[model samples]
Target: MAKRGEALRAAHLRYAPRKTGSGALHCFVLDCSASMLARGQLALAKGLLIALFDRARGERVEVALICFGGARAELRFGPAVPRWWNERWIEPVGAGGGTPLEAGLARASQLLERAARRDPGRARHLWLFSDGRTTQFPARPAHADHVTVVDCEASALRLGRCRALAQAWDGACIDADAMLA
Candidate 1:
């Protein structure tokens, strides 16, 4: 059940006047870790990323990329279109060391927050790619309007941590195979 304020907001959005070309922002937080290399998950994710970039190129969406592994995270591209994105660029991304999923989410949150400040009405979506090997849990960032956690875990014994993370954020959760399908 929706609260009074939530219902009112939903009503407003439901009946609101349409605006042409209200662009959206897509923040992709990628996991580049040794675990992802199992079952060629990292390779599959890279392929998906390229496809996603191609789709974004056809639309009025701004895309950002954040890859986390080892002990830290870095924003390779952000707050703008990736004019140089291609297979060649995606090939060099290394996968090793710790998962650092928390650091990745934190960095993605920062980017989302900044984008929200610039355009509060613009749609902000977060796409997290991980196998959920980390032990850290972080609160969902408020700036992200929507979140989807794509679990890359391929082990026979699955922990379902990605689904747990999605539930915690009230977001969507899908495995890589499901997503690809």
Candidate 2:
């Protein structure tokens, strides 16, 4: 090659490292039911969600929330940066209704699927807080990269359905207290 010296001249110094923690989505499915209201579980769950949203914000990870109760589920936030989350936004989250776990999961799955279509390489995580009060079962979403289930059920007779759901999803299962810890 006659450009041996040209190769050396063409080399310019540029320093960059692989980017990480960007384009990540954290989908939280919070169970806001009468059972959750019994022992302030709903409050605890909301507190945890706020903390999680803050952490995700610090990491530049997008956060989304789905609250299920009253036989309905709704997305409270989004699969975008949680820049708009604050105490006012967190205050209006009401409780006292039937636990619609399946509906929450279904909505989350839809969000994950849509996100996958938009950004295939983006990381997606699902976090569910439930008392395992429902008999309905929802399948693990194929679009989610990971899932974590927290059983908010605090009683003498535990159904262990939250753990079962976690097992089915091939994800980690922990208690509400454990989650805080």
**Estimated TM-score per prediction?**
0.86, 0.84
Question: Residue 104 of model 2: what lDDT?
Answer: 83
Candidate 2: lDDT of 159? Answer: 94
Give model 2 RMSD, 1 decimal.
5.1
Q: Which candidate number would show the highest lDDT if scored against the true structure? A: 1
Please give the TM-score that candidate 2 achieves against the real structure: 0.84
Off by over 4 Å in 2: 1-21
Instruction: Specify the highest-TM-score model's number.
Output: 1
Tens digits of per-residue lDDT for model 2, 37-152: 87777888888888889898888888899998988999988877877566789889898778788788889999999988777778899999988888888889888899999788
Model 1 over residues 84-145: C-alpha lDDT tens digits?
A: 57888989998999988878888998899888877778999999988887788889988889
Clashes of 2: 0
User: Least lDDT summed over 10 consecutive residues: which range in candidate 2?
Assistant: 1-10
What's the true lDDT of residue 180 in model 2? 79
What overall lDDT goes with each candidate model?
0.86, 0.85
